[model samples]
Target: MARPKDDDPDMFRIIVATDIHLGYMEKDPARGNDSLVSFEEILEIASKNNADFVLLGGDLFHENKPSRRTLHGCMALLRKYCMGDKPIQYEFLSDQSVNFDHCQFPTLNYDDPNLNISMPVLSIHGNHDDPTGQGNLCSLDILHTAGLVNYFGKTSNLEKIQLSPLLFQKGTTKVCLYGLGSVRDERLHRMFVHKNVTMLRPKENQEDWFNMFVVHQNRSKHSATNYIPEQFLDDFLDLIIWGHEHECRIDPEWNGIQNFYVSQPGSSVATSLSEGETVKKHIGLLQIKGKDFMMKKIPLETVRPFYMEDIVLGETSLNPDDHNVLKKVEAFCTEKVETLLDKAAMEHTGNRKQPTKALIRLRIDYTGFEPFSIHRFGQKFVDRVANPKDLVLFHRRKAGVKKEESGADNELLAKIRPQSLDSARVEDMVRDYFGQVEETSKLQLLTEKGMGDAVKEYVDKEEREAISELVKYQLQKTQDHLKVRNASEDRIDKEVTHYREERKKRKEEDEEVAEALKRAHSMRSQSEDHPCDDDRMSLDSDEESRTTRGRGRGRGSRSRGAKETTRGRGSRGGRGSRGGRGQMKEPVIATNGNRSILDAFASSSSSASQRSARGGNKRKTYSGMDMSDDDDVVTIDDEDPFDISSSSRKQKSQRKTTSRRGVAFDSDSDDDIIPLPKRRR
Candidate 1:
């Protein structure tokens, strides 16, 4: 294949990487700065290559709530390398309001007149740095707010995802970059299967553009519904930049069924000491000219080399019954460690600077022998390896046991089949437990998936109030539903009582489930065929087939190359909107409830003519943005708990000046007093 010419004016050059995992083990002594150093190198690479922009797939930060030090390091790097006065060659043609709807400043950093940005950095959030909490903010949101990075692909409405690509044009070559930040795999899978995902195409000349999709989902199938199948993606896409999986498969692999090439740049830093991390890490320098593209894999030299190997002692001549068995095993392990150290030394022979230390993991299978002290063994190489504490792992194979004999073993076997090593998701475990129970006995108000999501949030993000908040939210929703149904006071009370009882019962059952899972984890099999699996869901072929066919049919039925425009924008709105720059629409603000904050502010200033024009009941438009119904308008008294004003005494006094859901005229000033909605009971 002929490569794109270096000085081609039409070519769009982009530096692509993913899963930088900044702040991963930042507290560690040996590998604390590994992620940051590699990330800096990526930026330097982009600068030296004179790339148009840097596109990160996801997982830019290892933690959803990264430490201040991590945030400072990331911000400093971006400021140092990305901010400049270099002229951007590409023309951004996408609607900024729709692409960066989550942000207050919808425009890209480079486009903003207040900031002087040269090398633009565009990124989505991965599972590690996905949004959480009441505000639904992520680490990238901070970077975006600071005008250091252009954050896109955030969908507040998970029920229906409308992917509006960021369209860019350089000379005659047009590129459409579509991004979807990390979504819960199962929910996203179901959405795709049900054909709820929509990819909004340009109004005209769509075939002339090279389309690229950047998604941070499970590319590798973990379970039936835990992964997004490549076939589910639109066939129009030219390239797919996959993230989340840490293996560095930077070479673009052709997906014949989907007719798109997938390039997984993988994690810049090794987050784990697994065998997959041993692959040479690289970031791709992608050049797109018209519809043709070429990917050049650029090696990352700052990454700490990780070497992993497994040895089966039983398969060797070593016998457990031998009197010198312990000494012999120790000698064998020492020899393996020395060999890995030599290999690590050999890896740094090139002009690249040597890393702090190499990471090594040796898995020993002492099937019929007693395990030795791993801590003592690791002390010998304390200065040699980054992870000395977990240098060696001892495994003992499980014997053929009957299901009836061991409850723990039976549960483990039932949950994890021999053919697959992927662990069941928290949601799956919750569903299985509920499925086994009688339908009448199962909790009615709280759903298994909802509880599962809450549990996962609590466990993974350390959000202490996740479970309590879910319980409260569910109860409130139930009460609202019953009230809407016009249930009697007695009936409502009875329903509430039943719900509480069921919740209590469910809590007790959850404890029992937790204990069983703990036991299963302890007695997990370590056989080569069924090694311990990570916290990922399993895959299903049935769901994949359903997703492929349903999505394919759905796409075929939609208008080809038709633009999806928001109301009041223009006749030819959305990405193709040629409306004057001065006519920029106000961003549609989303509140906690299905209410519009702007509607509340707009209601205070509505004139008699405006009211008459709205027919007193129709939805209103504010600054070319459609507002929600009056009933869904957020008012002062109904202040969001996450809002700073919720705890302010001055704000409370201001709200008390107006009546509930009533407008009052101020005698002192010309302004009309806006009534506040009553607080929820």
Candidate 2:
């Protein structure tokens, strides 16, 4: 109905709801949650709030075979709210009216233009309701032909009559309602066809025209579209309401203008079979105060709240203990139910999980039901609970945690919240989850070589040779590198440790020297103060007298003897200094030096162990000398080991000359051939 009124120039009113998965749980007769409570509630709120028009974003039904009860529920709800001037006959016959239910295949040839509450009801198809999946293909034809709703599920705009401008007055603001009744399906190749572009085109582009686009695609890339480039929602759009997922959320980030709004009204009911489903039931209420539209969220939990609390029923057998346990549980529930009824009202019904301040969305999960009458409990539980009309009983047949082939329960089973077991949509979620995981796994396998069973067999003969050659080259290189690295590291470590030890020793020696210097300074100062001053000592004690002038026969003579002794000490120190130069080259400098030389020879003799071991094994002469096999020992002997040194050569020549003169190193049966000393020990 895209006809704008010239009288009121500035504003238009619209209400948008998305992703109402109607007829979702009809087969779940045990739960008896066949009614689309969310959608029904939205319709009531929209009607009560006096919205100009309402939009169903998508997924009008979960399948093609929507039950007659579902159809009647939808039509009845729509008939009340979707019209401004509908016939009075369409209303309930009496205040104490019977709940109307539709017959199977209810005929609807009664579409008319002159009705008061008969505004166009636009709808879209969501992923769960689209073909190519477990969705209905003919949900639209059935819905449209029933005179229940107007929708767009075609590739080329099949219902231009509803989108036409003839449905509004000359002065009344017109809203060109367009709906992509069915969302996209990935299984179909898009040959690049355009997506559903709904425009609230004003009559001849009036500046007051507002577009309320209704759609059923994901805000992100979902399974609905297989195309690489997503259908960009960048046309002459004001606000595009979306559906598919069951969580009430709004994206204020769209279009950078803050004028675009989208909502997945969460489902039309509290009950969902989806995994990880959190029921945040929401609806958008738009206020048309001028053209500046204000949108506020109406969570269904506000008026008709949902309540789910844990009820632990002990052993439910007929035993006395079991009976007592059940009584205790019943007592607890009775107390809670009373408290809940205290806050509940006729319009505001409290369910298992109390939704005290959102929209009217009811959910009560009666888990741990024993062989007791939950029906009796439901009937007598609370007051003004829409008694029999709003109250619904559910019998949960929980399949115990799935076990593994080894009879061990799955690890994830513990992680799963028990509330998830109440939903049947978990299967769809699991399938999708596994599908994504499988695709990712496949990609990883294709890229990594070790993921396949026949990876070894898949290798070509030439590839094997190439790999082997690469490994051999790598091994050789690694060996060479390791040898050099090991030798360097070992040598550096030894040097570092040795330097640290030397530093420690030097520090200790310096400390000793400092102490000795301090002692010497003290002694020198005392001696200076008392030099030949026997009188100075006499002032403190009765001692010998002093002889200051030229040393007569007194304490002075003894002092002169002391000076002579000091002079003698100086002479001895000079002599000692002179002897140090000659001592280094002498073999008999001291027994300590001689002992050190003998020890070096002994160590050299013992170190011949390494030589024997090396000589035994096949010599692996690597390029670098760093070998993990430490058979090669470094022995510094008194005799020269480095024959290339100049001193060593000279010593060897002298030795050869001595040998010629029969100056042999004669040892009494301990004769061993040794290399010449590079430097004197």
Ten-residue stretch with the least lDDT total in model 2? 542-551
Q: Which stretches of candidate 1 lie over 4 Å from their true place?
A: 349-353, 401-449, 472-681
lDDT of 2 by residue, 265-375 (tens): 555554443332444456776544323355667766422344433333332232334546556555655666555555444435354433333211123344554434566
Best by lDDT: 1
The model with the greatest TM-score is 1
**Predicted candidate 1 versus true structure: per-residue lDDT over 1-681, tens digit per residue:** 248888799998999999999999999988888899899999999999999999999999998899999999999999999988899998999889999989978889998898988899999999989986546688999899999999999998867899999999999999999999998787788889889999999989979989999999987777787799999999999999999888888999999998889998988988776777888999999998988889999998878888989999988888899998998898889999999999898778353644857889999988887778899999999999988899998987777864565878778868852222223466667778888999687767776766776677667676655666567666675787677768787687567656656655554334332333333333332222353222111111111111222111112211244322112222212343332211122222333222233432344443334344434533233322343332112112223547676546434533542222232232222132232444554
TM-score of each predicted structure versus truth? 0.66, 0.38
Measured with C-alpha atoms, the lDDT of residue 227 in candidate 1 is: 91
Count of clashes, each model: 8, 43
TM-score of structure candidate 2: 0.38
